[model samples]
Target: MKKDGQDMRQEGALKAADLEDAVRRADPDRALCARFLPASVRPDVEVLLAFHTELTRALAPARSAAIAGPMAGLIRLQWWRDVLEGARTPDHELAPPLLLALERGVLCRETLLRILAAREAELDPQPEVSAWRKMMLDGAGGLQRAVGEALGVRDAGVLARLEACGAAYGAGAMLRHWPRLQQSGRYLFPGDEAGLRGEGNAFLSACDTASLPSSARLAALPAILAERDLKRGSTQAGLPRGLGDRLAVMHAGWKATRVFQRSGAAAS
Candidate 1:
């Protein structure tokens, strides 16, 4: 290869490695993170993995903060965005992972912007479900389009596929959290365990059995649909071919909370 080509390849590889590492950090489930094997992904696909990690982490700080206090999650999101856009420089080494991932032609500039916008949406004191849905979709919807281009697709249709994923994933979130919303009078994001299950189980049932093929497992998983909500299974376990492992982790975390309650964590 020419020197220029070699340099480009090296840069791509570094970004890919950084993204994969970042995503693994974000997943919060060791078993699920391991599913992305060493050989299954191309270097360019790290964009999504990194995205998965960052977005998940952005929503989780307050809960993980281990102190009962005001919501600090959005503060953390702004803190990182400030660092990434050079508004502030973080002291931690994880500071530049997303910025480094940006150089690989993995996404347009708006990807991170949209993610921050979504975080802001999440930070609202109160949010309507419809509005929150739009915010969530915006963050991830463009990624497939961006990745299609980077992966050499001349005209790969991204909107339709990502819309499908967003709808399914979003429905799963609402269905999973319907009961919680009814009780708390607040719209919740991921990483809130008790809050999610307190919502109506009926809505989840409706969402699960809804006519959409993408989310048919909202109630009865049977392995295919269980893939999105649970992280323990392998590809051989028969989930559909296209779902992101992060969705699977989300599903698993919800279910684990149920199990923990049954075992008396919440009650205790």
Candidate 2:
């Protein structure tokens, strides 16, 4: 029994290291921002982000494949749905860590399903801007809420701000990845570029930080950065590389910390 226990510990550690590596490779920006989190909270947040990265990456082959095509993507997503619903056991490397987090309540089944649904929608032949917008909002809101839960934030106002921030981030992502999305043959914004930009700007304008809880500020930093990128007309393939991106992330983190501190002081 002792030998078995020791083996389980070894396996668990390996799984965690793999998940961390996946997150670092798939979403380095989030990985960088995660450095600001307390050690206890970082693992859960990383797992959530890793799960998200896995889903996003799954869409790539389908986007690029002309033979097996989007059907292949749909099947991959369905497998995730099956794993989440417990209809099938997880065998994929990424699935085990996410499954563990789900079991531990670090992640929610409903939110996972919603995110999967958004991903599945990308396979649609005539994807609408409205549908994309709704998916973005739902996906971002669910992620922010999950992060807030991991951070022990329970304030309704703070949670609401996190959700708004998420939506804005989603909008900014759409703009930033416009070229790639177009190349992928996906119509995330359809034909209404102006309308899409208008909605993204509106979401950014509505993200109020003054009331956000201190513990939840790190979870809100992506949204803050997204808003800044949108304002600066940044529409690149990925988060820009080099000194500028590093400085932007650092600046956003600093601003969020200040807001959180002020909120704490007022409550005291």
Whole-model lDDT per candidate: 0.42, 0.69
Report the CA-based lDDT of candidate 2 relative to the real structure: 0.69
lDDT of 2 by residue, 1-268 (tens): 1122111223333465555666666666677777666677787788778667666766777778879788878887888899999899877655676787778876677767877787877676455666766676667766776777676777777766776777787777677666676666654766554666777777766666545557687787776557655765435564454577667778877776676567768888
Strongest candidate by lDDT: 2
**What CA RMSD would you report for each candidate?**
14.4, 5.8
| Runs off by more than 4 Å, candidate 1 | 1-51, 61-71, 90-92, 125-127, 140-157, 173-268
